[model samples]
Target: MTEQNRLKQIIEAALLAAGKPLSLDEMIGLFAESEQPEKKRLREVLAELTEDYDGRGIEVTEVGSGFRIQVRAEFSPWVSKLWVERPPKYSRALLETLALIAYRQPITRGEIEDIRGVSVSTNIIKTLTEREWVRVVGHRDVPGKPALYATTKEFLDYFNLKSLNELPTLAEIRDLDSINRELELQDPDKVSDEQPDGDAKAAEGGEEDPETQQDGDDAIPTDEIDTESTVKESEAEAEPEVFAESSDETDSFDHLDSAETPSAEDDTSDQQIDVDTEPMDDAEQPETEPPAVALSDEEQTPLKTEIDE
Candidate 1:
């Protein structure tokens, strides 16, 4: 059989076996013939097959785990018209949260909380997340490490919006005063230079404030110790004079005081040990001359010395 025909038969059998949407990867694994099967061609074939079934009683939708051939939702009204049972209605909080997300996309939970004036319900988010309508787009570089959530492409399909920009403006969002607008003000995509853990490289080797830099990835170390002895030694050499000269309360360099540094006593001990071994290091060190003449005042008075001379 031709590749297309064989693939059609394979997909038809896979559909029968899966009884649900089959993912692109799943199909590739099943029909991947040789080393690196032609995935692009396969995708094209799948698209063609999906198009072939478009006008029929069924539709192909990418949902949950994979793509599936399911009855057209547009026909749900005609099919279920007799029974007339409505789909479950979402609660007010869920709808409000969804609307906020749908309108001001890529928003963080803290922003949502701020707008709602109440702590966000995890279950509301969980339900939206489970529905696959909302997804983590990015995070805010803020104190709490809040995740930025946005409506997905499936959200667009479900809500019948073409794109995020097509959503009604905040000025028009039904009777809810705009707060997520501020939430949308912070865009992770715009701040692409920052780290996932919120580590941002400041201008001229300056450090980004920790409060302003992290989004709370638990795998990252919250505090990084300067383990290099050189750093401690340099700070030890610098601190007394550094503090004496600076009076700025805002200076973060004051962190040097909190950090462990080599003290003067430690340096004195090191110097005493070094002095005992200075002879060995003489080649590497400057040499000093020993005293050659000694004066004894009792040996000769000034008048007696003059007469004798």
Candidate 2:
């Protein structure tokens, strides 16, 4: 074989056997000092290898770390069967946290929580660190000295990404449903119902609010109404009744006060009282309803005369 053919075979063997990506320097180190090829010639060989894999099941890919030989994504379904263990299932929360770290590096956990509107779980961070997909680049100068996180080359390798630049833009990320479909980041538990959640619900299929329901052909779902605003509106409607009841109570109390006080317009309304009037003591028996009494013959004399007349 020619020297060029030998060099290609050596590099290919190193890549396949390494079980990980190998940089150009590492690939070149596979040869003796005198037989090592220059980077330019190595690039040519890699190009040739890529072309050789154009229609093949496996291909040579250059990710952020270096070049690797991996099975093409098209053959994953079959290639995946070689492994007995089921792929680890990632929750949507974990995927989202990862995406944030990838897109916005040197970001703090608090900042991630701010964007996600929920606190990041400890397990999510631990998993990323354990996987070597993320690392603390530095600490922020702010209070508490929060550790700033950034994605590592292994993350790119796992995703088959060339670099951070190859990641989807924020605008593309905004189309979460489509991106989720492309990335297969759906959480089986959450998506079992097949209904979208969070920001995706509004963006995908224009789904109606869960609060509202459709009855028939005549009913069309209205826009998602704010529950808080609805509650405020109901309170506003109930305010007048509350005010009227309070006003009535106030007026009744005022009437009672007025009755107890002497009034110039109604002098005859005051009851006749003697100077020897005495207030009842606590020991006195409480007043009870008057009892009926039978009248004597003299008391009935006036009633008998009136009836006879």
Candidate 3:
């Protein structure tokens, strides 16, 4: 077999013999031999080996600062069904705390607590210890010294990380914060109050345009007002006045058309003509008297009394 393939077989043998995940650093010493394989060469070989397993059931994954070989998660249920084994579940919060410590090893619990913003309960520390995920790496030399913790090989194996560097980037961490904040916004009740007032004020500050504000300032000369609102205002004002004038003229023409016109004669002449055209009086002609029949003396007496004769 070629040297790289030989190295791959050696690494695989080591993993199989070890029966667990191994750190690149730990694997480094083993790869160190009479040949004295360079770190770069080992990494390339490991990469080539990892790629070989891509389509296969086994995989090489990095967690914390190390690497391990394991079956892919998709096949877990089938493999688990055969073995009657289900892996232990780590609550996301607990995993976050563990990952922080794993990547930032020799980290104090206070710092972890600060990151978590809650007191670290004893059970959390104990569970990690029992699971062999974390170990008491060392203690700080500072005052009132606190114990420092670091992730173990088990953490690497569990997470399938090749090395601490292979752990997700710090940028990814910041993105996680953003994503979490967004999730918090998904809850309707806390959205308004949860956002910091200072952050909001800062956002409002960045968005403020001083020039725009200055444009709105009252100190501007009257010339500016005449310049800005003048055109629109003039158009608005002139249109209605023009419409009104046109309407007035139209109405005046209509009134003139519908007016009661005088006759061709002058007003005085018309009045004289009106007097000349009067009807002849009913009493001026004998024909006005109705033809009468003879009446009895009593009727004639009543009629003579009504006529005052």
Off by over 4 Å in 1: 16-20, 32-36, 61-66, 78-86, 116-119, 129-139, 151-309
Q: Candidate 1 on 47-125: residue-level lDDT in tens?
A: 7778888789886655545666666777877887777677779987888788878766788887778877787899999
Compose the digit string of candidate 3's lDDT tens values, residues 162-239.
456667654345545533342232343334555787687778889756665564455676577788798988899999
The window of 10 residues in a row where model 2 has the poorest summed lDDT is 267-276
Sort the predicted structures by lDDT, highest score first.
Answer: 2, 3, 1
Candidate with top TM-score is: 2
What ranking of all candidate models by TM-score puts the best one first?
2, 3, 1
CA lDDT, candidate 3, residue 50? 85
Per-residue lDDT of model 2, residues 144-262, tens digit only:
99999999999999999998889875445544764454345555654655565555657874666646665677565343346667888999999999999999999999999998976
What would the TM-score be for candidate 1 when compared with the true structure? 0.43
Whole-model lDDT for model 3 versus the true structure? Answer: 0.73
* Model 1: residue 247 alpha-carbon error in angstroms: 78
Counted clashes in each candidate structure: 4, 0, 11
Would you list the clashing residue pairs of candidate 2? none
